[model samples]
Target: MRLVFGLVLIAGVALAGGAVYMARDYIAQYQDQLARERQATKDALANVKSVPTVGVIVTNRAMKYGEPLVKDDVRIVNWPEDAIPEGSFVDMAILFPEDANGERFVLRAVEKDEALMKVKVTKPGQAAGLVSQIEKGMRAFAISVDVSSGVSGFLRPGDSVDVYWTGSVSREFEGGGGEITRLIQTNIELIAVDQIAGSDVTGATIARTVTVAATPEQIAALAQAQNTGQLSLALVGVQDDTVATAVEVDQRKLLNLKESAPAPAPVAEKVCTVNTRRGGEIVKTQIPCTN
Candidate 1:
């Protein structure tokens, strides 16, 4: 009976050793897998950090038109260098100078996290007005427009339009003058309409006058056209890039009238006279000359 108990104990010891060996094998495989996953995670993070980035100044909160912008209104964020926006303020010093006497103002509405661009804000000590919006070497010309000529107030700042002139041309001009409508200018940009200059203007505004940014020569042409005839505005599509050719229409052209040729002048009849010397005064007789 003692030998039988000893053999049973030996069998139990063998089973326990086998279980420990299997557990060690399983643990070794699990540890290797965990180490591999950890290395993969580290490699991914390193690859992400390899890409270059740039620091760009962006607005921290929403900004409205003509709103003052202080240093606290913006913050620098790390942006992808390749995806950086044009005219973005990468340096805070350039955007807000230390010696500036006044703060800048927002020219247009900007949402949070939006890049602070030069076009979206006014310069230091500058006000957000028509003067700031005008381009260099360009003059702001005001055009009088009514409900029909103004596109029913669909116009907004920064919109492009074609100007038309409609009035009578005097008989002093060539081509037998009459009332005509002609396209004077195309693709002219409006900087302001009446007092509103913001491009984010909502709804239709029946403006009495609109200011346009034009070169000196263009301003002169527009001035003459406005004076000689009534000026009308036609809104141009945002995506339209085609230039309009010279267009003019008169009453004849509108009705597709065909002009007739002028008639020939009347020819004078030639007469032959025969003279008689029988008397003191010479007598002459008329006869038809042969052609």
Candidate 2:
């Protein structure tokens, strides 16, 4: 009987030892998993802190040109700090001041969620017009255009154009004489076409006059060119960065006619003069002479 009892007790002790070992193994695995999860969370937080951001004001809905920019029209969004655009309004106070004398107006069409930039909006209490659109140190000059000269009214504000002058040039000009077309200005920005100054113009507008933003020097050049000859606008492609060279085309060049060399002037016969004293006056006689 004593031997049977000892065997039962030893088996009971072995079972308890195995149970404890299993529980310890399970607990160790759980602790290791918890540590890994904690480390992963820390790594994720560190990555998030590496990037900087800024709050930029963007339009909540599509805004049109000349539309009033009220407080409800814009909202702040997190924008990448390094990628923030120039002239962007990041402060709400500056964009919409309480003591503002007048409301601000949109100068250009802005799409939904587009950043509200200083160049696209007018100052507080300012009206949206050619004056507001003109940049600092730039003057607004009007150029007269027709169907032939205006690119058929396909131009819109904010569009870049190359100005061509068509008129007669003196013989001293490099393009010979007669009426010729020459590219006088390249990449000139148009601010208004006729009475429409918005970039969201839908259809082709046959404009009579187009206003352009230019420096004083550019305005002077354009005024002189417009007065001296007919000014034509050639629409420049948005993606085109190539500058138009000294492009001049004459009637002869258009027809692929080579310039005929000017005829040499006939040499006058050499004259020999003889002076003779007669009374009180000197008389001169001309005689044919050799070369």
User: TM-scores for all candidates?
Assistant: 0.77, 0.70
Tell me the deviation in Å of residue 43 in model 2: 7.4
lDDT of 2 at 54: 98
Q: Which residue runs of candidate 1 sit more than 4 Å off their true CA positions? A: 1-49, 261-291
**lDDT measured at residue 59 in model 2 versus the true structure, 0 to 100:** 98
After best superposition, candidate 1 residue 227: deviation in angstroms?
A: 1.5
Write one digit per residue (lDDT tens) for candidate 2, span 22-123: 999999999999999999999999888666999999999999999999989999999999999999999999998989999999998999999999989999
- Residue 233 of model 2 has an lDDT of 90
| Candidate 2 lDDT trough over 10 residues, lowest sum | 173-182
Clashes of each: 0, 0
Give candidate 2 misplaced runs (Cα > 4 Å): 1-50, 171-176, 259-291
The 10-residue segment with the lowest total lDDT in model 1: 43-52
Can you write out model 1's per-residue Cα lDDT over 57-137, one digit (the tens) per residue? 999999888999999999999999999999999999999899998989999889999999999999999999889998899
At residue 38, candidate 1 shows an lDDT of 100
lDDT of prediction 2: 0.92
lDDT of 1: 0.93
